[model samples]
Target: MISSSRCTHLLLLLPLMFSFFVMGFVDLVGIASNYAKADYQLTDTTANFLPSLVFFGFLLFSVPTSILMNKIGRKRTLLLSLCVTMAALLLPVFNKSFAGMLAAFSLLGIGNTLMQTSVTPLLSTVVSDDELSSALTFGQFVKAIASFLAPLIAAWGVHYNVFGMNWRILFVAYMLIAVLAVMVLSATPFSDEKPADTSGLRSTFALMRRPMVCGCFIGILCHVGIDVGINATAPRIFQEYEGLSLTHAGRITSFYFICRTVGCLLGTFFLSRVSNRRFFVLSVVCIMCGLIGFAGFRSETALYLCVALIGLGNSNVFSITLTQALQSCPEYKNEVSGLMIMGLFGGTIFPLAMSMTSDGIGSQLGAVAVMLVAAAYLLFFAFKIQGKR
Candidate 1:
């Protein structure tokens, strides 16, 4: 029988994990970027601005959100993030103007930045140290469930014309879920970490003095860059090489997310028994092979196989890198969490780079070239983690 205290703890953990799903709402930027590109007849460079705008919020808001958490408490901060997310989703429903979407994507980034700043550290308080890595990976699995669904939902909205609205209906559906998440989380009570003095940007920067912290920070950048890069480019790859229509090509994005969702689900179990260093290196190698195979081959079957490989390989890198930073400076979890999430600006950096490279070379192969560089960095990071356990 479950003890009362254990039951209470489980209740607290549920809402915190549910917020991870909310955190994933930002991934919609990937498919939304393509939709906007089609609607506007945008160049690769211009359409990428949608995703770039979304991640740019991470650069501007992440550290401040951490400081805000220290002042307001993590739970209240999380609620604030949800409120911001709801507002962002509503903007598109009311007006689908280009400027309106830019604003919506920016707010979406800000809300997700705030949620990422608080959610993991908040989860750490409920679970034990030894359990932290696997627990976070499970949180990631929940997050991927949302990421996996975004493209499918967008595709459905496009096809069915739900509510006489098109892809914008995806925002409406997500906004409703956000409202539910907020209500459930606000009603639940959990003990908060006492506010910390190290919330300042100066102190957050100081933590970079630690070698592992810096390495993990860059590792995060590469992980998110590749994740977002693949998401934004997968459909285009199909369109460019196979001459498929956008609606049909969009399924490739869904396929990538499907593999990623499965990878995170498996990671939660394997991470319990396998050394993180060992598992991380193997994952990196899988992506490296995928990228190289992609650069060399254009066959439809090879494309599908390599994309699935990239998805499976990239899946656990974020959770693993994040848990490493948190464990490295357990006392500084809040500050470190902010700095690491700030690295998500890589989502902005890579997509823009991929865009220009594609434009410069006049092919999606330029984007593939950019991802290969990202995969190479992850491989090097993998070796850095060897024997650390």
Candidate 2:
């Protein structure tokens, strides 16, 4: 058994840091898309497409990777993910050509999506159950930190001409982070406890068939749509209509992450005290109100507040939903967890849908309005929550 003191080592944070690095790079793919557009003189539709392709990786890998994790075990699963991440990071070095770069982005997307799915479940294993909420929140808090610093990292890469040939210097950074994650996983000891019959494909499918699994799956799916849609749309609303600098708009975006970090902390503090149902239901209402506030008006200050509010709405959705999903089917937490992460594909589908809609209408705000409709739909699920025994 892995001892608590061993788990307390900073190495525990290595996964968080590496996960953050992967997440930061993935989220910041937008910067690469923008840079590629200018350098290559690509069309608007094509340029706008880069991030969505990366998002598609999230859709594709969430479930399959988790099943892989279940069969192969978490440590090896993570190693496999990191290897792909390394390869993806090197894409720009070899293929600065448009097709090459898009392929690279897609590779990066698949690699990172798998990394995220594995890391979250991996973290859940290392920490004590009482501290689960706190550990998860801290992981997210660190993730917010990564999301926080990504732009700055990208800006420095551009400022100094780090890549020199293509904007692939960022990939070097990603590679370094992956190496560190690998080192951390090697050094640290985590519970290798995995669900039963994991190697059998039939058992995995059987795990998914449970109603509890289905509910958590949908809950995670809807929540991802709610969260990703808000993040994607808020920046656009500020940049296009509110007339904020893209950099300034990012600050507002940071506020959403900040609110999410806060919500995670709050959830950690009260996880034992408050019922998940109450929290999930209330958060859904808050998210809708925040999105509606964004849609209803075009105020800058108001927009920032709403974005933060939306963050508040979603701050605990991941934790609450994951917990609920596990609670619903404790007999198969790993399978259920994998199933839950698959729901994260909503990140890909919802944002892409919003972006395509906005492009069709020639308005960024219209994209946000589409998300408002999504948030409203989520309220229905939030109403159905019942804390499992």
Candidate 3:
């Protein structure tokens, strides 16, 4: 049986896990919203604003919240983040204005940025090393679950006719998960100790200069961009290019995430046998091939294979990146983690940039091009590390 202390700490994982529900919706629809925006009589540029707005909040809020955790400790930061996460998800229920949804996404981004930075350190405080990757990968499993489930959520709302639209009901359920997460974290026994002395703004960069740290940070940015890239584009590729309805397309999208969750589960076992550095390199190669496959072909079966491959290939990235970043600075765990998540500012803006570029180029294939760029960097990082080793 798990100890009561361990149980209490693990309970906190629920809120962090659930925040992805709001995040998944925002992440998955980066490209799909082109359809929604057009349906609602909006410009492609205006539609692309949702993703940029979300990450903008991440950029603005990540460091301050990380410092707050240092001074006040994990639990309070978590509660505040969880509440914001819930509010962010629920805002669309009452207000459907494009600008309002953008505001909500911004709040959600800030909430997620805090959760992303704090919860891993919080989990590290709780779980043993044997279970560390397990817990982290399990979070990925839940994240994939949220991503996979989100499209169905959008579909269900369509079937039932909520908010004169479909995806709004999806946000309703995401808000409920956020509430449940908050309740669990409130009851958990996480510590209130300061995380780090992040009071000085100059410290953020001073903290960033450790060898391999920037690579690790940039690695996360690229990986998130890649992960978000697939989630963002998979639906449209499956629906428009593959010719499926919202529901059927959603089911196929779910398969990609299911494969991702499985990859992480499998990664926990393999980490004992393989080095993370090697795994990340191979995963990037596999993802490169997957995206290139999508670019090369139009067959539905092939699309499913490629999408699942994309998730399976890169599922280990976040854990691998975080582990390396922290391992590089064993003492400065929370600060490093904060800087790493703050790097996710790229995930938000990159997708929106891709969308706008697609507008000018007259093809969403610009999404694929954005992905190849990320993969190229991954390959370069992998090579750079190999040269050093």
Candidate 4:
């Protein structure tokens, strides 16, 4: 039987986990961008900019958000993120123009930067150090569910014409959930650690001087660069190589997320038992293998297999890399979390780079080439892990 204290902890965790679901909302930019491309006839470079905009805030806001968390506390910081996200979702419903969507996604990015920075540190407040990796992986599993659903919901909205909003219906649906997330999280209570005496920008940046923290930071950059690279490119790959319609090609994105969802779910258990370094090595191997297959194969079956392999491998990268950074500076968790989340700016960088390469080469293979570079870095970073757990 669980103790009352353990049960209370679990109860409090429910809202925090739901907030992870809200974090997944930012992933909509992938499918939403594809639809936007079609809706507005955008060039590859222009459409790619949408997801880039969604990630740009990570670079700008991550450290500042950490400082804010030090002031207002993590829970309140999270609440502020949700409020911004709610406004982001609300924008598309009222204005469907290209500029409007861009503005909305920009807000979504800013909101997500805050949420991503706060959520894990907030989780640490509730969970034990021994359980932090598994707990973070589980939270990611929850986030993956939201990631998995965004494409399907948009697909369904497009197919069924949900209230005639079409794909924009996704924004409406997620907005309502954001509203609920805000309400639930507001009512639930959790204690946060006192602010560190030196969470300033200088101290946060100084962490990069440590080799372990620095390597993990680059690993995060590569991990998210690969993650968003795949999220935005998978459908395009299917379309380019298989000649599939956008509707059918879009399913590849869902398939990728399905594999990612399963990976995160399994990781939540496996990470607790396996050596972190060993697992990281194996995951990078899978990604490298998938990238090779993606570069060489045009067959639909092979492409699908590659997507699955990459998704499963990449699923736990963020959690493992982040756990390393957070544990490295246990006292400056908020600052470390901010710096780690800032690496998500790689999302912006990778997609734009992939887009330009694909455009220049006239093939999705260029994009795959870019991701291969990221996977190579992850492979190198895997050996840098210091622990058995």
Candidate 5:
């Protein structure tokens, strides 16, 4: 029979894991931006702005959200985020204008920013240090489930005209899930650890002065830049190189997430048995190889293979780098969480940069070049992780 303590632990974890699914909602921005571009007849640079707007909140709101968590606790902050996400998802269903969609995505970014900042540290509160990496990987695995599903669901909605919503059905479906997440998480009790001291923006920024914290911050920046970069660009690559329709090209994004989902599932077990530094180095190598393939190959098959490499390799980067930063300064997990999450603003920087580079060069190779630079930084970061030990 299960002990009450063990049962309670599982109970606590289930809600948090579901929250990770909610966190995955932000990834919809990729396919959604593509769809929005097609619908509005937008230029590549203008379409890129959708995702940039979505992630821009990380730069503006992450540190403040951490400060908010200190006052209200992580659980409450998480709930607020879910509520905002619900609003975001609900908006496009009613307002189909481009401006309306822009507003919706902006709210989605802000909500996700709040959720991302709070959820990982909140997970640390429930699990011990040893289990944290595995737990975080597992959480990402759950998140990837939602991430991979977004494109599939959008495609399904477009094909079937589900409830006459077309692609906007993605918003409705996710809104319902966000509502469910809010309900389930609200009902479950979490013992939120109050921060030992208050954290302001200044103190949060100061955490970056520490080498491990700074390196991990850049690691996160590169990790997210690549993740968002691929999500936003892969489908276009398919279209440019293979002459595929938007619907067909969209599957490329789903395929990337599918590979990532598999990698995260495998990582959950592997991280428990292996050292983070070793696993991290291997993951970075996979991404570097994938990016190299992207630059050199033009075949559909070759591109798909490269996507798989990147997805698998990048699957556990966020968890590993985050765990490193949190472990580096156990006392300031909240502040560090904020600073590290702020690195996600790299999502904004990368897509805009990639878009301009690709547009200027008149080839997707320019975008691949940008991601290769990010991959190279991750490779360098692997050495830093080793040095930390």
Candidate 6:
């Protein structure tokens, strides 16, 4: 009977976890930006704006989505996000104009922002406190599966001439999955805890005053900044050093995500037994090494090694940081989740800084330097977590 109940619990959790895969749809912006660059003949700085647009929604919608979850409930909020994402994916299918692509990506960002704000908190409700970090890490592993697939699927679309739609057909494939996620999650019943206190922008901002909260917020900022930075910059490194075409350079991007997927899969078990602080410190060191190697090394093999290190190091930072914050202040999970998701605005800030620097220096190494600074900040954040849960 106990095993039966556990199986039932696992069955229900499956669909919620699938939503993490849907959340990964936002990462399509990286490859999509490259496609846009080729098609529009835009400069690197201008092409970079596409990713900036996708993440900009995090700045505008994360906090509000948190507040909305309080009123409507997490599962319902997730469904809303899925619907928005479906709409976003459909737009580019019919029209490939720059304006149409921008509109589609904007909606993609908004939906992903809402999904990020609500989905993890919803997962937290399902699992016990002790399991939160591991569960979230596993969720990240699932998300990385989708991330790693984006470029491959786009490349496949171009190769097979599927639907005569080019890489935009990736959107069509994901739209169908989004519809399935909506249906499954809607039918699965989740008990949402009512808000005990009214939360708004003021209260959410007030969390920054707490040293721990502030540190975690900055930790998330650096983690996401690095994640987006690597996603946007890795391909360029291959292109510059090896003279690989965009299609082949994309394999390096997939390699980074593959390492991340494996790292998160391992982290799901290790985090449950190892102290979060110890593991986090180790991960930060790995990222710093990767950053230094990426900045200094010009050889193809060396650069690939560095990319793998960074991916492995970064895989669990978000899950670890977020779970620690929620555990410390269990009362304000919604607000904390909102603030953490807002830290994803680092996605916007880091890529823009990298773009500007890469343009000025006339080398991809300039962009790597920006990530080095982000990595240094993560090193500091790791120290602060030494004795923390």
The RMSD (Cα, Å) of candidate 2 is 3.4
Window of ten residues with lowest summed lDDT in model 3 = 26-35
Task: Report the C-alpha lDDT of model 6 over 317-377, residue by residue, as the tens digit.
Answer: 9988887777767888899888889888888888989999999989988888899899898
Residues 1-389, model 2: lDDT tens digits: 86877758456667655665556556556556656766788744566577667767876676677678877788777777777877887877777788888888788778777777777677767666666666766666666665545555555666577747434576777678777877766776667777665534456567678776776677777777766565555665787776765545545555676677787777777666777777777788888877778667777878777777788778777777677676667666666666676677776666677777877889876666777776666677666667531
**CA lDDT of every candidate:** 0.88, 0.69, 0.72, 0.91, 0.91, 0.88
How well does each candidate superpose onto the true structure, as a TM-score?
Answer: 0.98, 0.85, 0.89, 0.98, 0.98, 0.97
Give a tens-digit lDDT track for model 3, residues 1-84: 899867766565556565544445445455335435645776556666666677776677777777778877887887788788
- What TM-score number comes out for model 6? 0.97
Q: How well does candidate 6 score on lDDT at residue 199?
A: 91
| RMSD (Å) per prediction | 1.2, 3.4, 2.9, 1.1, 1.3, 1.3
Tens-digit per-residue lDDT, 271-354, candidate 4: 778889998898999999998998889999999999999999999999889988877888788888899999999989999999
User: CA lDDT of 106 in candidate 6?
Assistant: 89
Error of 5 at 366 (Å): 0.8
Model 3 regions more than 4 Å off? 1-35, 162-165, 195-199, 243-252, 384-389
- lDDT string, candidate 5, 20-54, tens digits: 99999999999999999999999889999999988
Ranked candidates (lDDT, high to low): 5, 4, 1, 6, 3, 2
Better of 5 and 6 by lDDT: 5
Best by lDDT: 5
lDDT value for candidate 3? 0.72
